[model samples]
Target: MALLELEGVTRRFGALVALDQVAMAVEEGEVRAVIGPNGAGKTTLFNVITGTVKPSAGTIRFAGESIGGQPSHHVCRLGLSRTFQITALFPEMSARENARLAAQARHARRWQPFGGAGVFRQAAALADAALEQLGLTSIGDTPAGLLSHGDQRLLEVAMAMAQQPRVLLLDEPTQGLSVEETAQAVDTLARFLQASRMTVLLVEHDMEVVFRLAHRITVLHRGAVIADSTPDAVKADPAVQDAYLGGFA
Candidate 1:
């Protein structure tokens, strides 16, 4: 069985049909890219999977158990995690502090009673490890609010790693980053997934990142999956070229 499965999942906002029986399956330790134009329900799907939103129909099964209606915290505690498109960091805290906080959360030990233990020890080590992996170690001590825009983006990703989730959901992780920053982020993520064998689902407009990292790509158009195939196959689909590339048709 696949590690994650969504069958006939649907969500609605008044008259808006955000997801129309969108079905997807993610196997263990694979990267699946969900690509589409704006308002295509990509983020909504992420929210649903991560428990930020509930589906109006169908079922969601993770590791063979139903999880469609659980709260987000419940979902996170169950080994699923996500990073926002917007950098969600504690601006007042230094980057190292933020990462330490996340690592502390991951320990899931009696430390929970202490408010925020593990901030200065191995938590710091985990933070430094994550920062070094993402090439953010140089600015590790800087306040998140003071870093450059691209560094802020990388920090959000590092924070997500703090939890060390098995299933990682990233929403527009490379948004607003320069080409060089984008490449760096991609290379960093490639190394992480390759070594950690984490299952990743990324929502992005950048086809290059999708094509580069994803083993299978699903195209969402008008709240429905128009195609699901390997990167090369999806790129060659005439409909994908027409809808995604426009006049490149």
Candidate 2:
């Protein structure tokens, strides 16, 4: 069975259909990229899969369990984690602290009156490991707000990873980054993927990054899938070219 599956999923906002009978399946350890022009329902798809937005219709399954409309926190606890397009961090907190909090969320006793010192220690270890994986160990003590924008982006990814999720959804991870920063983030992520073989569903505008990391590309246009295939195949597809990749190919 596919690790993540969405069948005939639809979402509407009044008269507007943000997602129209979308269907896709992501295999275990597969890196699937979802790309499109603005307002093509890319982010909405992520929100729905992550349970931030309830689907107007259809079913979503992760590890063969129905999860549609279950709620964000519940979905997250089921081993689905994601990073947002906009960096969301506690600016005043140190990088390590920020990551530690995310790790703690995965602990079963996190809500207990006294989760205990062991829980905090374990969370710290996981956080530090995530930071190291993202090459942010040196700046672990720095306030998240003081880090460079590139580092901040990387930090958000590290925080997500600290949860040790089975599926990671990255929404425009390299958005607002300079060329150099983008390259750095991509390289770091590439290395992590190689080591972890993590399943990822990415929504990225940078075609270069999308092509480099994706095993399969699924293109969306006007709230529906226009093309879904290998990167080269999708690039050469006439429909994809006319709709979004006119000059990128």
CA displacement after TM-score superposition, residue 237 of candidate 2 (Å): 0.6
Model 2 per-residue lDDT tens digits across residues 227-249: 98999999999999999988798
Question: Considering only N, C-alpha and C atoms within 3 Å, which residue pairs clash in candidate 1?
Answer: none
Model 2 pairs whose backbones collide: none
Instruction: List ranges where model 2 is wrong by over 4 Å.
Output: 108-114
lDDT of 1 by residue, 1-249 (tens): 999999999999989989999999999989999988899899999999989999999899999989997998777867787889777889989998888887776665645554553434667777888787677888888999998777787787787777667788989989988899888778877886787787889888887788788999899887888999988888889888866746331
What TM-score would each prediction reach against the true structure?
Answer: 0.90, 0.97
Candidate 1, run of 10 with poorest lDDT: 110-119
State in Å the error of residue 187, model 1.
Answer: 2.6
